[model samples]
Target chain A: MKLLVVRHAIAADPVEGQRDSARPLTSAGKRKFEGVVRGLKRLDVKLDLLLHSPLLRAVETADLMNALVEGETRVTSLLARAPSKALIEALDEPSVALVGHEPYVSELVAWLVTGERQLARGFPFKKGGVAWLEGEPVPGQMTLASMLTPAQLRAIGRKK
Target chain B: MRPAHRELEPASDAVEVDCSAVRIALQEHVARARDAEDSRAVHGLRVACARLDVFLRLGRRRALRDDLRWLRRSASNLRDLDVLLESSAAGELDAQTVSSLSTERTAARAAFLEVLASERCEALLDALANVPSVSAQRARAPLERLAERVRRRGEQLLDAPAEFERHHALRRALRRLRYAREWLGMDCTAIRALQDSLGALNDALVRETWISRVERPASSALASATSDSSSLVQSLSAGALHAWRATRREILELPA
Candidate 1:
């Protein structure tokens, strides 16, 4: 199974800055995310399942990716959190792209790949960075394949 | 040995104090054995192995890991032979059941029982007499490690930048936020409601994308079809145009 973990694009501040979940994507964030869609297409990555966090910004991000890819996208609360045994059991995809926020992505990566309690580090994915993992679905079997920032993506696109 | 409570520590440190790798290996072996046969004994063995694995992963801090280890191994051996016998009997019965002969079914049952006796199912039972009560403490370490990883990740998401292009960061943040709530063991009513609303909005966008890309083209094709048909077709096209204008008005009036 291959898991593509993506961070959502920049978003506007929520009304009165109520909570993180209430935030919306900024205009710049949208354009940059569209660029990400282009980058994924250029890479020729075929997604089987696209799962998003049930946050407005995350949902918007998933929508953009779903538009780019040829599959169904689901907004799952399971993808909204770090690794839960329940979430792991609930997953029924061979290849999945998750659109969510940080720390949890890093944490989930660490947990699934190492079976150890440690945080993932050294991948400074900006507002539109992607981290891809490829390996067995079993715990402690996956390995990181690539981490790309939006700037890196644009650079690659320009190079092509 | 009596169980002893200890302060929480890293898995590495705990392993050094009491090796859990051995127990994990044994549990794996038992599970593999169970998978090889389909029988009551195998089911029991699988359950026992699962329990041992859970015990080693979630048990209380003070429990004796070595005692738990010994009990698991003993149980594995007993369950292995019992599973083999039951599986042999069940397989024969399944074959007999498929055939339409009462005598063959009876003979199959008798042969299965004979094989069970020869397999020394009683000897396995005798060995089980000395099995000890394995505490559930052995299972705590893995669960603790998993929980810690989730909590740290949740904290990271909470502190991460909200705007990111790849959407992975935002997704991770949302997951961690939800995981944090789970870790805190709070009620899920508010979280569920928020999740539902977000899901609905996402579905709406997906539908909109599909309509714009696919349904609109089809609709336009349908509209053009009337240009070559009867006068009634022209009237139908006019009605369709009027309906489109009305639909646009309704959409414009909708709350943003």
Candidate 2:
């Protein structure tokens, strides 16, 4: 099985006293992440399903990908935090995309590749970055196949 | 082993020891408050002041405490009014009373803006930019001290949740603790949850107090207002008490 772990794109600056969960992606953010998605398509990336955090920013990010990937989208609190063992165990899709926030996304990548969740070992994803891994659906079983930043994705996306 | 909510909380970015970032944040909050049209801006301003107050305290900027206090106080009445108006039963109050409260709110907001525009306010924001830079390592000693006080106060508050004053004291203590944690780039959702529950309880209590002061004898409208506010007070107290019992130790004992 293969997994594409994506960090959310740049969201709007949080208005003072606004709910963090309600801050959506800015128009520019949407445009930028769309390019990233196009780039992923160019890279032959595909997904059967996309899981995202319930937070507004991540949800919007997932929506952009779903528009093109035509994948089923699901919300999980697990993506908002550390990935649970159950999350990996329950996965049925051959190609699933997990969209979420920082550190946690990186932590998941670290745990999957190294069988340990270490900040120092984690692959920090830039905003809109995606790390592609392939392996059995268990901790330390996955291998990092590819990683792409927003700029690289956008650049690749711009190609014919 | 990091807890789930710990991961959800925004881990502070690499905290630069500089005070300018904080000062700029506070100034932006103040600017928003100056033209605010909603409760959010008022709340944002209040939280900003409280956060900066803790920063000043941590850096031993004792002389500026009064300015911070004054800035916070200027908004207190308006904030209270905003909370009251936002309450569900605020509509139940007699039209005259509601009108009177609205007028008071308007005046209070004017006063608050006037204070914000004052020379003193400018000085306070200016002073913020110049607070002696505190090394992250150096902030630990005082933060640890505050943590002890918060734990002690949490114990007292849990013992006497009904004591009106203890609620205020513990709320302040928890807020200070949370801000200190933010400065050091740590967040405990438990602390944030506790503070929010306490604030809800406090808002309910303040609504009760506001009505009692303005209540008119034989006024059916006032009577309805009191009933709704009393209900809120009871429900919120139960929620706050329950939250305190559950998270008190976890949040209070969190090391600085």
For this target, which candidate reaches the highest DockQ against the unseen true structure?
A: 1
Residue pairs with colliding backbones in model 2 are none
Candidate 1 lDDT over residue span A1-160, tens digit each: 7788788889887667356665767888988888888888788778877766666677667657764445555545555667677655545677778777777777676777777537466444567788888887556777888888888776665556
User: For candidate 1, lDDT tens digit of each residue in B39-152?
Assistant: 444334434433333332342311122223333344433343343233333333233222323333344444443433331222222212212223323433444454455344
Tell how far residue A123 is off in model 2, in angstroms.
65
Per-residue lDDT tens digits for candidate 2, residues B157-203, read: 77887786787788888889888777666756899998898898888
Model number with the top lDDT:
2
Model 2 over residues A10-31: C-alpha lDDT tens digits? Answer: 9888789877776778889989
Find the 10 residues in a row with the least total lDDT in model 1 chain B: B123-132
Looking at model 2, give its docking quality level: incorrect
